[model samples]
Target chain A: MCGIAALQLKDPALRPQLGSMMHAMLCEIVDRGPDSAGIAVYDVERFVHAGQSTVTLLDSPSSDEELSAALAAELPSAGAVEVRTLGDTTLVSAAVDTAILTAALRAVAPGARQIGRGTHVANLKGVGNPVDLAETFGLASVSGTQGVSHTRMATESAVTASGSHPFTVDDDLCLVHNGSFSNHATIRRGLRAQGIEFDSENDSEVAARYLAMRLREGDDLTTGLENLRETFDGFYTLVVTTADGLAVLRDPIACKPAIIAETDQWVAVASEYRALVDLPGIETANIFEPEPGEVYTWEF
Target chain B: MGVLNEEVVDLHVSTVRELNSALHKAHDGEHWRVTNPGGAHNVAVGIDSEIDVVIDGHVGYFAAGMHQKGTVTIEGSAGTGLAENMMSGRVHVKGNASQSAGATAHGGLLVIDGTTGARCGISMKGVDIVVGGNVGHMSAFMAQAGRLVICGDAGDSLGDSIYETRIYLKGQARSLGSDCIEKPMREEHLAELAELLAAAGRTESPSEFRRYGSARTLYHFHSENSSAY
Candidate 1:
């Protein structure tokens, strides 16, 4: 089983302090999922577009100098691609003509679009252990107020870093799933008909894309989550991180476990309470298992 | 004797391994006094020797799960699935029990003093269970072989698709499933009820009980009985 940890900091100063806490929470659940770990922080002011937008990943791990040069070079035709580096991995966030960025990144590197972000976007996955990804991208010390992190077990998908979780849809919403999607094939076909693109053949991405499409159609995160819970048939506990807040939802059967612990300072969610074991004042915290079919939302 | 009136063994422990190990050492033909058992799962699980293990408070899921060859008693309400999948042994609860009590149990005795939730004794194999208060809906559903004795009213669809299990109730059942029916009480049944009542620690007369069992018409699947599925 894969493990997911999402922390919504009530304090802005604590926002940057989240990198260690996210690392701390994910490290505790190392046993649940040990393959690869990834974290995504959404700076809403940076990655939104007014009209038609295109998102893609930069192929090569760009240096700070190389990234600034590329941004300076691409900004004339491309609308805006926000640049944020976790360590060695630099995420160039952009919303432009899909055809334009697609041509641009491919001309620079053959597989550039493989690491890209788009409209209705999400970006938190890697190819190895959380430590390796943290080292490779410099996430061990990075922090943000609201984000989602996942360590993968790789049951359905191959054990590649890209197959690890917190899958993003279009770039606005990111979802981490604990259980399998029973009706994934049917939904995948339906989305394919509706012109949704996919990278990997994982059910979690399909789930994320479905929710992202719903959110894009003017549904709030909570409403989109409820729709996903109603439409999707299986045992899944999903924690969705968006620009405004985070929403946690569980399937009706509740075959999977999702625990919630909250304090006046922040609200933390994990597959088990053991993930929150290291947090101070945990003994006095109001912790509980999330009820089946309930949507729990925490705004950052 | 010491100055203390009684010795209380505080079983305020963590982990299933620790709790079960302490119970084995304490229950050696002496009355073991325990308190503050806060929601421990599988407390009396796999205990096959004859001893009285008394718990002071509530228990978590599967408290007396799979018990055999001993008597385990609980003082307060139990979480989901108490005495689940138990084999021969006795589990006596003084308080209420959650859903699926005695579920799929084989060759044991489960006695509940209060109400049992939905699907109580569901798919029971051969265990004998007696409930003092009302039982929830779908009790004895898919039951294959066992005896369920209820003193209070039974909820909807009682004995749904039950197989060789015998059912006795003092109050009314909402409905009976296919192949299950109310039957006339015989002298042999009255004798069996007397033993079950004595085991459950009840002074009530056995004649108040009514017997229910398979009609045997559904021993084999027929096209006419296909609707039961």
Candidate 2:
């Protein structure tokens, strides 16, 4: 079992409390998953710089200086590159075309794994206690309007930094999963034949890639999730975050556990209610479990 | 009886063992109050005697699981497998519940004041589940006995491969599974449903519901039924 928690503030006034609230939620579910933890923060102002693309990297073999030099040589048109280290991941922000910069970074640091590329989303993940990982990344102090976090138990693939959760396949898009996919291999082969590359052997990564492909083809968030329902086979409770919204979806069978508690100020989705019990205004929130095959989305 | 006071245990400060031990040691008709459950899993499980347990906050998985002869009430939402495999007595949740709320339960009354997630009564052998709100997909799957009363909507595939478990739905059903057909509600069914509603503290009229059960088409395998299979 894995623990997944997501929060989207309906009012921007609550953005400052997002990190601490998410940290508290993750701590409640530490027993559900103790192998690894990850969080993707979408602070519109802090993480996302104007005219710049932020890329998160995991297991970087090169130091910041070497990586910066390589990026400069690969993309001469790109501006200065700034890198911040957090645990095993690095956040790189540069004023350049996102696609070009992503490709250049991939080539320069072949040993480094890309976590996500976007304007607002910055992800940090590692193998350890979720609480300690949160502290290491200063999650309680980082401010964000919306975010998604996960604590993984490693049911399908090896437990490593590359295999950790909060897998992002597109700009400002990330997915955290709580269950296994039954037909991922078949779908993975299909995507590969269509020229889509994968970074991990995780089933949830395939789902993120599938949704990203759909979104890239101009499908809306709701339609992409609906298509996901038709194509994927498994028991999953997914918390998907985008540039403007957050969504919660369960498999058609609804085997996995998920709860949604919403108040006037925010919407929170977690694998269990205890994760939300401590949230502000939870006592009066309208809490319910999302129905199977239904995508519940809240746009910021 | 006049001198005995109701026992109160705080889950925030006391262990589950302490609360359960008190229940196990209490005599018949003893009342216990559990405060600050904080959504802990497996609370108040395996009770074998007639008693009363009132939990003041949310509970996690398997709350009142394998229960017997105890009336347990949760004031907030429950995690998966609430009252699972219960053999007797009544278990009630005042708020929404997670998946498998009454899975495989036998001989008990499980009531939810709000909605319940998928597989609410899956694989139930003998139990009566009454939900004030909606029930998720695959509810009552492979049920062998007892009844399920849903006051609101039911998600996809209600009563798949069910046997002898009478389902009464007051609201819409997305769809029914194979061999599970909606049957006409008769006078006897109305009376039975009325009793169940009363037991669940609901005031809805039984005539508003429709009954569903097995069509007996898949009960026996034969060459003629090969295509159906």
Best by TM-score: 2
Q: Please give, for residues A233-266, the per-residue lDDT of candidate 2 as tens digits.
A: 9999999999899988998767788889999999
lDDT tens string, model 1, A228-247?
A: 88888887989987767788
Error of 2 at A16 (Å): 0.7
Instruction: Identify the leading candidate in terms of lDDT.
Output: 2
After best superposition, candidate 1 residue A273: deviation in angstroms? 3.7
Question: Which ranges of candidate 1 are over 4 A from the true structure?
Answer: A10-21, A41-68, A76-89, A93-110, A113-122, A128-143, A262-265, A278-291, B1-220, B225-229
Tens digits of per-residue lDDT, candidate 1, B105-169, equal 99889999988766789999999999998887788988998889999988777898888888989
For each candidate, what's the DockQ?
0.08, 0.76
Number of the predicted model whose DockQ against the real structure is largest:
2
Poorest stretch of ten by lDDT in candidate 2 chain A? A42-51
Tell me how many residue pairs clash in candidate 2. Answer: 1
Q: Write the per-residue lDDT of candidate 2 for residues B119-195, one digit (tens) a residue.
A: 88999989999999999889999999999999999998999999999999999999998789999898899999999
